[model samples]
Target: MKWEHALKDYKLYLKIERGLSNNSITSYGLDVEKLIGYLEDKHISVSPLNISKETIQQYIYELAKTVNVRTQSRMISGLRSFFNYLIFEDYRVDNPLELIESPKIGRKLPDTLSLDDINRLIAAIDLSKAEGERNRAMLETLYSCGLRVSELTNLKISDLFFDEGFIKVTGKGDKQRFVPIVQSTQKYITCYKNEVRNHLSIQKGHEDTLFLNRRGKQLTRAMIFTIIKQLAVKINLDKTISPHTFRHSFATHLLENGADLRTIQLMLGHESITTTEIYVHVDKSHLKSVLQTFHPRK
Candidate 1:
C-alpha cells in the first residue's frame, strides 16, 4: 500500500485499538511522515510493506543528526511501534525497524520549583486584573493537583467532587482516575468558577469545561504554557518551567516528605511503577531513610 494509506490506517488503529490521545497520534504520525519525506527526497519509490531495513537505517542515521538524543530515541520508538502494528495486521511478513536500537541516553530528571519559588511565582500574579484571579486559580490547581495541562484544561465542573475530596482526571489514552483535591485548591477553583467563569457567556459546548479562556471557551495547552512562562519571567526565575514541572515538583515533594512511590504513582496516574521510580533519584536522602526504616539489616 502507499505510505499515505498505510499511515491513515495506522492512525485509526492508534485511535480505535490502542486508544492513544490525539496529540500522541499526531506525534506518531509525524515520525512516519518524516520517513516518507526522507524517501521522497532521495527519490526512493518503496511501498510501506516493501521498505527495507537498510533504507530505514539510513533514514534513522539522517534523523539522528537533526534531533537531540532523546527526541531521536522517541522518534525511533514511534517508528518501531508503527512497523510492529503493520506486522500484527499481516500487511508485512517482517518489520523494517525491528532491529533498530534507540540511542542510550542518560535519564533526564524533571525540573522542579522549590516551595518558596512557587510561592513567589504565585505572589507575582496581578490580582487587580480579572484574569489575575483566574490565573492564580489555574496555577494553584496545576501545582496542588499535580495535573497535566490537558487534564487541567479538559477538567469539567462535574469532575470536582469537593465533598468527597477528589477530582476525576482523564489522562493519557483517555484513562480516567480520581485524584484527591485539597481544600485550598477547592477554594481557589470555587472562587474562580463562581466569581469569574459564571460571568462569561460561555460557548455552547464548553459549559462543563472548568477553565475557560476570556473568549468563553476551554483553555488551550499553549495558553497554559504561556501563562506559566510569563509568570516565570515576571518573577525573574532562572528555571525553564512548564505545567509538567509542577507535576514533577508535586511527586518529588511528596516523596521527599515521606510519601511512598506507590502512592505517588497512584496520584500521578502512572500505569507502571517503573515510571514512578524516577522520583527515587530526586531525593537520595529519602532513599537512605527508606533503607534505614525498612531494611531488615537496619
Candidate 2:
C-alpha cells in the first residue's frame, strides 16, 4: 500500500482504537512521514508493506544524526508502533522495526518553579490589561491543579464544582477525573469570570469555555506558553519555563510538603504511580523528611 494510505489508516486506528489525542496522533504520523521522505530522497520505490528492516534501520541511523538521543529514542518508538499497527491489521507479516534497538537515554527531570518564583510571576502580570486577570487565573489553575496546557485551555465553566471543592478535569484520551480545587484557585477563577469574562462578547461555541481571548474564543496552548514567557521576561527570571513547568512545580511542591505520591498521582490525573514517581528524583530532602517524620527508628 502507498505510504499515504497506510499513514491515514494508522492515524484512524490511533484515534479510534487507541484513543490517542490529536496531538499524539499527529506526532506518530510525523514519524511515518519522515520515513516516507527518506525513501523519496533516495528514489527508493519500496512501499510500507514491502519496506525492508535494513532500510528502516538506515532511516533510524540517519534520524539519530539529526536529533538528540532522547528524541531519537522517541522517534524509534513511534515508528515501531506504526509498523506494529500494520501487523495488527494483517497487512504485514512482521514489523520492519522488530529488531531495531532504541538508543539508551537517561530520564530527564522536569523543571519546576519555587513558590516564590510562582508569586513573582503572578505579581508581574499587568493588571491594567484586560487579559491580566485571565492570565492570573489561568496560571493559578495550572499550578494549583497541575493541569496540562490543553486541559487548562479546554476547561469549561460546567467543570467547576466549587460547592464540592473539585473541578472535573478532562485529561489525555478524554479521561475525566475530579481534582480538588483550593479556595484560593477558586477565588482567582471566579474573579476573572465575574470581572472579565462576563464582560466579553463571547462567541457562540465558546459560551461554556472558562478562559477566552480578547476575541472571545478559547485560548490556544501556544498563547498560554506565550503568556508565561512574557511574564518570565518581565520578572527577569533565569529559567526556561512553560505551562508544563507549573504542572511539574505543582507535583514537586506537593511531594515536598508531605503529600504522598499516590495522592499527587490522582490529583495530576496520572494513570500510573510510575509516571508520578519522577518527582521523587527532584529533591532528596523530601525523602529524608519523610523518613525522619514517619519511620519509627527515627
Candidate 3:
C-alpha cells in the first residue's frame, strides 16, 4: 500500500478507534512526516513496511543532533505507535521499531504559580482597555477550571451550566466532562459576556465560542500563549509562563490545599489517574498528611 494511503488509515484509526483529537492526530502525523522528510532528504524511498531498524536508528541519531531529548523521545514513541498500528492491521508481519530504544530522559514537572503570584499576575493587567475585562475573565477561567488551553479556547457559552455550578469541557479526543465552575469564575465570565464579548462583532461560526477576539473570531492557541507571555512580562514573574502554566498552577494549588487526586484528574480532563499524579509532586508534606489522616491503620 502507498504510504499516503496507510497514513490516512492510521489517522482514521486514531480518531475513531482511539478517539484522539485533531491536534493529537496532527502531532502523530507530524512525527511520521518527519521520518518521511528525512528519508526524502537522504534519497531513500523505502515504504513504511520496508523501513529497516538501522534506518530508524540513524534517523534518531540525526534527530538527536538538532532536537531536545524530550522531543526525540516523543518522536520515537510516535513512530513506534505507527508501526504497532501497521502490525495490528496486518500490513506488516514484523515491526521494525520493536527493538528501537528511546533516549533516556527524566520527567520534568510543569511549573506551578502560587496563589499570590497568580493574584499579582491578574492584578498587573491594565483593565482600562477594551479587552481588559475579557482578559481578566479568561485568566480566571483558566485557573478556576484548570482547563487545558485548547479546552478554554473551544469552550462554548452553552456549556456553562452556571446555575448548576459546572461548565462542560471537551478535552482531548473530544471527550466531554463537566467541571465545577466556582462563583468567582462565573462572575468574571458573566462580566465579560455582558460587558465586552456582547458588544463585539462576532465572526461567523464562532458565535457560541465563549472567548472571542475583537473581530469576533475564536482566539487561536498562539494568541492565548501571547496573552500569558505579556502578562508574565508585565508582572515581572521569573518563571516562563504559558497558558498551560496556569493549568499546572491550578492543579498544584488545589493539591496543596487538599483536593483529591481523582477529583483533580476529573477536573483536568486527564484520561488516567497517573497523568494527574504529577501534581502530587508539588506537596510531599500534604501527601504525607493525607496518608496519615485517611489511612484506617494510621
Candidate 4:
C-alpha cells in the first residue's frame, strides 16, 4: 500500500481502536510523515508494508544527529506503534523498529512551585483587568484539581458540582473523572463566572465552557501557557515553567502534606498507580518523614 494510505488507516486505528486524543493521533501521524519525508529526500521508494529495518535504522541514525535523545526516543516509539498497527491489520509480518532500542535516559522529575512562589505568582496578576479574576480562578483550579491544560480549557459550567465540591474533568483519551474542588477555588470560579463570564457575549458552542477569552469563546491551551508565562515574568521567577508545572506542584504538595499515593492517583485521574508514584520521588523530605515516623529503629 502507499505510505499515505497506510498512514490514514493507522490514524483511524489510533482514534477508533486505541481511543487516542486528536492531539495524540496527530503526533503519531507526524512520526510516519517524517519517515515518508526521509525516504523522499533520499529517493528511496519503499512502502510502509515493505520498508526494511535497515532503512528505518538509517533514518534513526540521521534523526539522532538532529534531535535530543528524548525526542528521538518519542519518535521511535511513535513509529513502532504505527508498524505494530500494521501487524495487527495483517498487512505486515513484523515491525521494522522491533529491535531498535531507545537511549537510556534518566527519569526527569517534574518541577514544582513552593506555596510562597505560587502565592507570589497569583499576587502578580493585574486584578484591574477583567481577565485578572478569570486568570486567578484558572490557576487555582489547575493547582487545586491537578487538571491537564486541555481539561481546564474544555471545562464546562455544567461540569462544576459545587454542592458536592467536585468538578468533572475530561482527560486523555476522553476519559472522565470527578476531582474534588476546594471551597476557596469554588468561590474564585463562582466570582469569575458571576462577574466576568456572565458579562461576555459568549459564542453559541462555548456558552457551557467555563473559561472564555475576550472573544467569548473557549480559551485555547496556548493562551493558558501565555498567561502563566507572563505571570512568571511579572514575578521575576527564574524557573522555566508551563501549565503542567502547576499539576506537578499539585501532586507534589499533596504527597508532602501526607496524602497517600492511591488517593493522589485517584485525584489526578492516573490510570496507573506507577504514574502517581513519581510524586513519591519528588519530595524526599516526605519519604524521610515516613521512615522516621514508622520505622522500628525510629
RMSD of each: 1.2, 1.1, 1.6, 1.0
Q: Candidates' TM-scores?
A: 0.97, 0.97, 0.95, 0.98
TM-score of 3: 0.95
Flag regions of model 1 displaced more than 4 Å. 296-298
Q: Give one digit per residue, the lDDT tens place, for model 3 in 115-171.
A: 999999899888999788989999999999999999999999999999999999999
Write the residue-wise lDDT of candidate 1 on 35-152 in tens digits: 9999999999999999999999999899888999999999999999999999999999898888888999999988989999999999999988878889999889888889998899
Candidate 4 residues 1-298, lDDT tens each? 9999999989999999999998899999998899899999999998999999999999999999999999999999999999999999999999999999988787889999999999999999988999999999999999999999999999999999999989999988999999999999999999999999999999888989999999899999999999999999999999999999999999999999999999999989899999998888889999899999999999
**Candidate that would win on lDDT:** 4
Q: What is the C-alpha lDDT of each candidate?
A: 0.92, 0.94, 0.91, 0.94
Residue 105 in candidate 1, Cα distance off native in Å:
1.4
Indicate the residue-level lDDT of 94 in model 3: 85
Task: Return the number of clashes found in candidate 4.
Answer: 0
lDDT of 2 by residue, 112-215 (tens): 89999999999999889889999999999999999999999999999999999999999988899999999999999999999999999999999999999999
